[model samples]
Target: MDTPFEIFLSAPPGLEPLLLQEVTEAGFAAPEVAQGGVTIQGDWPDIWRANLTLRGASRVLVRFAQFRAFHLAQLDKRATKLDWGAVLPAGAECRVDVTCRNSKIYHDRAARARVAGAIESFGGKVSPEGSLRIMVRIEDDLVTFSMDTSGELLHRRGYKEATGKAPLRETLAALFLRQAGYAGDVPVVDPMCGSGTFVIEAARWAAGMAPGAERSFGFEALPSFDADAFAAMKAEAATRRDTDLRFYGSDRDDGAIRGAEANAARGHVADLCQFTRAAVSDLPRPEGRPGLVMVNPPYGARIGNRKLLFGLYGAFGAVLQERFHGWRLGMVTSDGGLAKATGLKLSAGPPVAFGGLTVKLYQAQL
Candidate 1:
């Protein structure tokens, strides 16, 4: 527990740099962007804190050890020598997930069996259905051992049970918000607020609430977990600064509006967010200085006809350009034609994979 190890913050692909920026801002030690995530050098406390604080990360994986093994027998020998009891709780039920790439031990199932056997020999239980997860990557004859410190995806903030079709994930929404230059100091509006993800995330950010404040993590089950220390860390990170800004959302679907309101309440930001049932044409600018209008309007892949989507986007763009003067705009959609229909001079960010489709963030000042 005292030895420093690699703490990996898994992120959505193409958004690694944004997540890296977030991890750096959150004061993680030496955060370096990796292939599909960000890596920092830390120990057990740092691992716990990363799981607790990072918003853009999907999961936190702590790399415990790495060794070279050219064959299954060698891998099993090295695996059995690892001090699993120091990290994994005795009799802890764990599921081993193994991947092999360009390695002599190329059988994933064989490697999983070898590791599982080693864990069982150390008094740990390896089950198909287990709360704790152990991840193994055998690449180029080198085996890397890591653990999933986040059980459920971090996007499940224990709220937002109600969702509309093709809803944006909370983790992705937070990263998009950051990429769109949302500093939590200005008001945010989501014209098509499906389940109010963007609006609720903005409201929570403005309220200074930690993203993991209301959730528990998989690290709690580890042998090295210190409940008292983690509790103290959470207490010290607690912040709820009063802000004058407010968040607003409007959707044409009454059901979506209702769900958004419910999500807001569960997120503890109902008082700060105002959701109403309104079409894009009827979207209203809140009574205050102009702020950012963030939206994830319907794209061709999601719903509606292409022609109708163009019309809808054009109308939505006109509404923002005409009424919301001095306000900025951010939109997420998979179709460039629909984005062009909006008529806003939005520059596209890197393509982000979401729900089996690639979407880009388009942003500009209105």
Candidate 2:
């Protein structure tokens, strides 16, 4: 753990800047930005903080080792010679998740099989449904090994167990918040809030809370898992600052309200957010704050009827103009036509690649 290391935090495309900010804020002195991820030089403590505080990152990964190996024999010898027992427990359930990028080991499945076999022979057990995920990426013969510092990904922050047909991930929500510059001191609203993801993430961020405060990580069972240190760190993190603000969200469906309630309870922000069942035209118009109204309305793919969606967008536009006057608005959608339906003058920032679908979060003033 004392050696030089790099931590990679994967993010959606065009959200690298948000991830970079999170890495720097987590105490990385010099963070180098890469496509879909960020790299930092640090020790084990840095890795722990990255997992704990980085809300916008999908998962935190500690680069255990990275070296060049051009052939299978070289790869096998290096894998066998590496100190697998240091980070992974002996006989602990584990599996290899590999990715090959521009490397001689382009046969991803074969390389994964070889690596898994090597680890198994070295006393590492393969647990397909295990809690930990060990990621291996081979790029230009430089094989890199990293462990999933986050167990179920950062989006599964123990909240939002219930999901709609098309659900937005919590990490992506946080990144979108960063992109929108939400300060958490104002009133934020999310109409068409399926599962209440944006509002809940806003509540957690506004409370000055750690994203992983309620979850466990894979490194807890490793040899170097320092219980006392972790306890102290968590205790230090327990001091909460007061945030007297409201996060509002609404959805037309009743099940989304139930899921949002369960998620808020798990996230410890049930009291901070207001969830209701209403259409975009009937969304609550709170007074006295200049916060942004961010929404993730359904596209034609998820919800039925393309023509009605345009009418819904127009209603959304009218509501924002009449009810949420002088307040800024942000909308995330894959449909340019639907976005055009909302008559807010918006400047396009960047497109986020979310779950095989490319989305753009458009922001404008009412």
Candidate 3:
């Protein structure tokens, strides 16, 4: 348990560099960018901290062991040699997921069965309904064993039960906030806010609250889990501090506004957030120093008509240009022409996959 292992921070595709920057700033050691995520060497406690604090990671996985196998017989022999008892708690129930590529053992189900049998040999239970997950990847004849440290998706955040149609994910909102150069120093506003995702994320980040503070992790069921130590870590996290700064959100839909308000209350940031019903044409500039105005409006693909969306984007752009002086704008949409309709001198980031549609973040100074 004292020996360091590989920790993988799964990030949304096309946002790996931003997540890498975040991990580096978080003071994790020797974080290297990978194809789908970032990899770092750490012990068990580092796993806990990564899941608890990282706002951009979609999930956390720990790679405990790896080896080469030519066939199912060889894979079973190598897997049985692993000290499963050292990692999984006695009689632990877990589900195994396997992916095979460029390997002699191309049957993923067979590999999963072999590994599951090996785990059960150590008095552990393999069940599809298990709370814990064992991840197996066999690529190029090399097999790797990993465990999902995060049971539910990290974006769940345990507080946002009320969400709007095609709502922006909290993890995506945090990464976009970072991309917009928002460091929690000033006000944040989302005029077309849905469920207050951006505003609540900004408020929590500004207040120094942990992203996973209100949630439980799958690692708690592992043999390495130290409940007392995890409690101490949570206790030592930065507490909420009173600040004059506020995060504001408004939407044309009254029901959306109500849901946003409820989300803020559940997230314990109602005092720092204000949600009201308003239209894009009537969006108000909050009274404070110029900050970030981040919004995820209807993409036309999900919530609105594509032909009618141009006028909507044009109105939003006009409002920002007229009222939001010195503020930065981050707008997300799937159509490039709609972004151009804003008539602002905006630049776009790389394409991001969201809800089966390709979206990009358009930014500019207002």
- The residue-by-residue lDDT of candidate 1 on 111-153, one tens digit each, is 9999999999999999989999999999999999999999999
Q: Alpha carbon lDDT of residue 152, candidate 1?
A: 94
Which runs in model 2 stand beyond 4 Å of their true positions? none
Model 2 lDDT tens row, 126-170: 767766678889997889888887777887776568887778888
TM-score, one value per model: 0.97, 0.93, 0.97
Question: Model 1 segments beyond 4 Å from truth?
Answer: none
Q: What is the C-alpha lDDT of each candidate?
A: 0.90, 0.81, 0.91
Which candidate comes out best when scored by lDDT? 3
Q: Counting only residues 3 or more apart in sequence or on different chains, how many pairs clash (N, Cα, C under 3 Å) in candidate 2? A: 0
Pitting candidate 2 against candidate 3, the one with the higher lDDT is 3
Arranged by lDDT with the best first, the candidates are 3, 1, 2
Q: What is the C-alpha lDDT profile of model 3 across 1-366, one tens digit per residue?
A: 336889999987899998999999999888999977899889888999999999999999999999999999999999998999888999899999999999999999999999998998889999999898999999999999999999998998888988999988999999999998987788999999988999999999988888888889999988889999999987766367677789999998899999989988888899999998988899888886999999998978878898999999999999999999999999888889999999999999989999999999999998
